[model samples]
Target: MKKLFYLLSFLILTACGDDKFSPGIPDIGIPEVEQPKDVDSVPVVEVPEVPEVDIPDPVIPESEEPEPYRPTRKIGKTYTFDLVEDSGIDQTKAIQDVLDKAENGYIDKNGDTIVNVIQFPEGKYWTEGFDVGLKKKYVIGLLNKEFIDIEASGATLYTKAPGHPYGGDIGKGRYSHRRHFWIENSKFIEIQGLRIEGSNTIQGDLLGTTKAYTPDFWKAGGLDRGAHGDVPAYASYLEFEHGYAVNESQNITFDNCSVYGVWGDGFYLGNKVSEGGSRNIKILNSVVDFVGRQGFAASVADGVIIDNCEFKRVRRAPIDFEPYGATGYVNNVRLTNTYLEGFHGGIAALGRGQVNNIYIENVKINSPGPDISCWDSAGKTVRENWHVKNLSRVRSYGSHVGSIRFKKTNNITIENSFVPIAKSQSKKSMELTDCENVTITGNDFTNGLYIISENSSVTAKGNTPKQEIIIE
Candidate 1:
C-alpha cells in the first residue's frame, strides 16, 4: 500500500511541472484527479543531484607563420617598360622598335637571318601579337645561337580590339592574312616568363570588310589578274584569337609562360604553308587556361616536348596532335608530369596522319568529359606507337561518359593508372574499337568494370578486381 501511494504521489508531482523536479526527469504536468481515500500515508522520494560538472573554454593558438617567399626564375637579358602610360597598340610598336633597334638582322652560315635579344619588364602590355620573319615571308633560315631571345620579367601581354590581322586557318588551306604572333619558318626562338591574354575577343573587324573565305573559283587560280592573284591561294582563316602560332619553326622553346581567355587554341604549331616542318620544340612549366579549343595543338611536328604544364578549363582537349592537312605528321612527342582539369577531352591525337613514338607519363586528368580520347576519323592505318602510363582520374561522374577511348589506332599501351569508380558511374571505364595490340597492366579498376571492346586485340594483366572483368 505504501509503495502504491508513493508511485501515485510521484506521478502527480511530475505532472504538476514544478521547479522542484530533478534535472534528469521530464517536467510533464498532470491534470487534477480525485484523491484516493488511503493516499495520505505516502512517503516522499528525492532524486540524487547531478554533480556540477565544469567545461573549460577552448584554446586557440596564434596564426601560422607566412609561407616563405619563392622568387620567380630569371633568365636572358631583362628590360623595363611602362604599359600604363601607353595604349596597347602603342606598346606593341614600342616593343617592336626595341626589337628593330637592338640588332640588325644578319645572315648565318646556314643562310638564316637572326634577330637578337628583346626583354620586356613587368607590365601588362596590351596589343595583338607580333610576327617575326627571317627576311621576307618565303625566305628560309636557321636561327643562329639564340637568334631571338625574349624574356618577359613576370609580365602580361594582352590582345585588345583591332588586334593583329588574321594569321591563317587551322587545318584547312585558308588564310586570315592577319598575323598573331606568327613566328614563321625560323629557328632558335626562346620565349619565357610571360603570360598571354586573349580577352576572349575575336576581332572580326580586323579583316576590314574583306571576305574570310575565298570563292572556289579564286582557289582554282582562276581569279588571277595581269600580275598574280592579290588574294592568297587558300583563303579560309580562323579568327584572330590565337595566343601563339609557331609555323614551320624549329628549335623553339617556351618556358614559364601562361595563356588565358582565348576564343581558340592557346598554341598552334603547324606546317600547312611552310617550306619545312617544325622540329626540336619544347614547352616547359607553362599553363593554358580558359581557352575555347585545345590547349596545345600541333601538326606536322617532330621531337616536341611538353613538360610540367598545367591546363585548366579548356573547352576541348588539353593536348592534341591534330593533322587536318596532308602535311600533318606528329612524331616523337612526349608529355610528362602534366595536369589537366575542366576539359571535354584530356588528351587526343586525331586524324588520318602518321603519329609515332608518343609517350605520356604521370598525367592527372579530371574533366567533365573523356579523360583520354583518340580517334582516327579517316579510318586509315594512321595512328601508331603510343605509350601512356601513370594516369590518375581524381573524380568520376556517372557511367554515361568514358574515362578512356581509342578508335582505329594501333600499338597502344596504358598501364599503371588509378581509376576509382563510384555507384553513379555505371558505364565502362574504357572503350576500345578497332584497336590492335592494346596492352593494359598494373591498373586499379576496383570500383568499375574496365573495358568494353568491340574488336578483340585486347590484352589485360595485373589489374585489380580481376574477377569482375567485364568484356562487352
Candidate 2:
C-alpha cells in the first residue's frame, strides 16, 4: 500500500466527445473546436508525436536474498491465531491460547490442522511466568520477534531439563536448555521474525549441538573446555525462517535474523569434540553481534552454509569452523557475502576442518587478528581443502600465524582476494605448511611478504591466466 495512489488516476482522464467539437483544419487563430481542445492548442504548432513514457525500474531496497528452494507462497492451509481470539486471551492466557491453538486439536475454519501461517496480531502482548513447550512437535510459522517479548521466567520454547535426554545444557555445556524457541528432530520447520531475549539455558548449544569449549566437550582435535547443550535433546532437523536464538542451544537456523547479547555465540551449529556433531545446516541473512564467543560458528558439522551474514563484536572467530575431536571429516561448507568486524578475539574464520571442500567467497572481514585460518592440528590425518575468492581483510592484531594460514590444510586455493595487514599484526601475511595440491592465484597482498611456504613449490610458473598458487 503506497502513499499517493490517487495520482495515477489523472493518467486516465482523457474523456472525448464525438461530433460536438471536431475542428477541421484550424488556422493560427484560437482553434475552432476539437474533441480534445488541449490537443488542438498545440497540434497547429506542429507538435511532434508524443512518445510513450518509459516506466522507471522498480527500486529494489537492500534486502535479504531468499533461498530459491523454499516455497514462495504459503505451503499449507493458512491458519490464523490471535492472543485476542474468541478465547479472550489476556496476559496470563496469551501464551496458553497460542499453545492451545498450535496443538490440542485446534483447526482452522476449513478443518485444516496443519497451520501454515499462524500469525500474532499487531499489538503489544505480554505473558507473565508462562512456559511454552515444544517437547517434540513440528511447528511452521513466522514468530515475530519484533512484537513478542518473553520475560526471564517465561520460556518461548523448552525441550528438556539438564540431565534429561533432551540435551539443552547451558551450564555443563554452553547454550543448552535455555530455550526461548527450540526445534530438533523436527524437519521443514520455518520460524521467522521472532525475538528471544533475556533467557537462560540449562545445558546446550543454540542450534542443537551440546555446549562446547568446556571440559567435557570433545569432537576430534580436542577443544580444551567443552560446553553443554543449549536446547533440549531429540530436537533435531529444523529449518528456521527468520528467528533469533540468543544464548540458547545449537541445531537451529537464524535466517534473515539477528542474535546478540548472549553468554555464547549468535549461532553455534556444532557438537563438541567429544560428541558426534551437528550437520546439514544453513544460516543466511543473519547477524551475530555483541556476544561473548564466536559468531556464526560450526564446530562439529558437515554440509553447512552461512551466506550473507554479518558478525560484529564477537569474542572468537566471527565465522568459525572448529571441528575439535572430529571423527570422519567436515566437508562441503560455504560462506558468501559474509562480513566480520571487530576482534572480540581471534581469527575471523578459524577453519580446522578434517577433510576438504570448505569454500568461502565475497567475505569482508575487519579484525584484530588474521582473516582466514587453517591452523592447529594434532596429526597428519586430514587435509581440509578450501577455495576462497573475493576476500578482503584488515588486520590489526595477530602474531603466531599468518592472515591466510594453512598448517594442517591441503588442496586449498584462494583467488582474487585482498589481504591488507598491519605490520604490527605480524611481519608475515601468508603461510603454508604441510599442505598438498595448494594454489594461491591473483591475490592482492598489500602488506608484508606476499607468500610463505614450507617444503612447497608453485605448480606452474607465471600463470596469471587465472592466478593459480600451489604449496606442496
Give the candidate number with the greatest TM-score.
Answer: 1
Q: Which stretches of candidate 1 lie over 4 Å from their true place?
A: 1-84, 87-89, 100-115, 128-146, 162-180, 201-240, 397-401, 467-472
Report lDDT (Cα) of residue 83, candidate 1: 54
Q: Candidate 2: where is the Cα deviation over 4 Å? A: 1-74, 77-115, 121-179, 198-254, 272-279, 344-355, 395-400, 424-426, 457-472
Whose lDDT is greatest here?
Answer: 1
lDDT of 1 by residue, 360-384 (tens): 8999887666767677667765577
TM-score, structure 2 vs. true: 0.55
Write the residue-wise lDDT of candidate 2 on 102-194 in tens digits. 421223455444334444444433321223333321112222211121112212322111212233343554223332333332223344444
Give TM-scores for every candidate, taking all chains together and pairing residue i with residue i. Answer: 0.65, 0.55
RMSD (CA, Å), candidate 2 to true, equals: 23.3
**lDDT (0 to 1) per candidate:** 0.65, 0.48
